[model samples]
Target: MSGIVEVAAAVMLRANGTEFLLAQRPVGKVYAGYWEFPGGKVEPGESVRQALIRELQEELGITVTECSPWLTRQFTYPHATVRLNFWRATAWTGEIGITAPLEHSAVEWQACGTAATVAPILPANDPILKALALPTTMAITMAESEGVERQLERLEQALQQGLRLIQVRDKGWPPARRLAFAEAVTRLAQAHGALVVINDDAEIARQAGADGLHLSSGQLAACTSRPDFTWVGASCHSAEEIARAGELGLDYALLGPVLPTPSHPESSGLGWPEFGRRLNSNRLPVFALGGMKNELLTAAQNHGAHGIALMRGW
Candidate 1:
């Protein structure tokens, strides 16, 4: 590897966010015929966002009206080591491949959350495809407040309504009761094709057969290796903690008290600007936590959150 080359990449999503665009590399380029997200090298004086906007206009003939930082990854190709700064482009103007001369041989929309139909995708994009499958909303169970039985009922209803990600986080419950509740949640979620993650208790997560484990901040600091779970995440409050979670290769993280919540009334929330600042150039997907509601999903995503993780609001 010589010097690191910075690249700005866009995952241009459809209006419903169920599909994203992939472009085939034009002949004569490296990895010609391989498919990848459309983007280009970042210039010295340009920010990643600026590069993204410019690249899209020049290549696809569209003006990116809305986008947000998502993930940053580095891959060492035989030719060069590229640092890919991935952004989620939600809204754009003008028709793709019409406003400007086509830069690539072809382009097509790929379905999100499923195996890609396109062949010979760039190897560096495998993890990016997986990350895009995570839902935009995560519901945290409040069994202690609602009572496990009522909570279970609510969980079933949410699942029916298409809630696919859940976190069981009642630390106050007795060990036996907590385990039972986790098991029940796992079963219910599995039935609906949803995923369940137990909070802080690896033993209980295993016993309940949950899909993953969520480490508390303390547990995150104490952990020396990634836990053996299909999906792992951590509760993070600051940039340092978020970076730590990423270093551990966790799938995602919950960051913030983006707004003041009933759970912690004394501390002021990080606010959106600060929240976005902390998440700038971060690698893993992160959900906005604390006082989050369904209506704030767009706001959260605009400020670099992959989604919102809700407790009471859900």
Candidate 2:
């Protein structure tokens, strides 16, 4: 850790909040032509948030109005090791008036979840791009309560409304019924260019052509290796479980009971403060689960959640 430099980086979003800015390193700096999230090294007395705000103001001439901790990654370069703390700046003030005063040579906004025309990106940026591509809301199925036919109708409506990530968790059904339903959901999801994850069943997920598998905490603990899927995530209730999810190289994790719910009325929820504590400095993108509504996305993001996972609200 001695030579590891701490740096703060910003994934600055435009007014639409879907595209993010990437800057080219200046002429004399390391990787001069390489593109990266705009930021600078943290000063001796600065917290990550403080450094982020300062760096963005200096580099972009914009005051960050709303930002949140996003990702933490460490990479080794020939000169030294660096731990890059990334934040997603969803709102800002002021214009990016001129480039002469900025340290970067050039900057460009690229749409998330798409290939960038910008070339020769920094080696460490591949994962960052993937993380950026992940949708901010994950919809979990509640078909058992809603009834399969009614749920399907609701799903189609949600899909048309731009709900892209889904989790099919029809545990009340028998194995055959679950598999059949999973297949139906997968087909519908694929038609709309959406991704689906089958909950708690790798085989069913695979058979249904799901994009990934979502493991229950019990399943996550019992597994020795990540299942074969394009995306794999787990339900985590504790800090240790979150760390374990990272160790398993999972794409994301859902941490929750962030608020009390009708389904689990006896259980107390981890208030936003506790939710923030559990997710502090997490390397893996995490979703706030349980008692979530669509309007709470900002609240979730402010507390370091990658997004929210909800059963009722899309």
- The lDDT of each candidate is 0.93, 0.89
Query: lDDT score of model 2?
Result: 0.89
lDDT of 1 by residue, 205-313 (tens): 9999999999999999999999999889999989999999988989999998899899798878999999999997788999999989999999998888999999986
Say which candidate scores most in TM-score. 2
Q: For model 2, where is the 10-residue window of minimal lDDT?
A: 94-103
Candidate achieving the largest lDDT: 1
Please write out the lDDT profile of model 2 over residues 1-314, one tens digit for every residue: 36789999998987666799999988888888999999889999899988998998898887888889887888898877999888998887877745327777888989988998798799888878888878889999988888889888889999999998999998888889999989999999999999899999888998999999999999999989988898899999998898888888888999999998889988789989999999876778999998999999999999989999989967
Model 1 quality (TM-score): 0.95
Model 1 segments beyond 4 Å from truth? none
**Over the full model, what C-alpha lDDT does candidate 1 score relative to the true structure?**
0.93
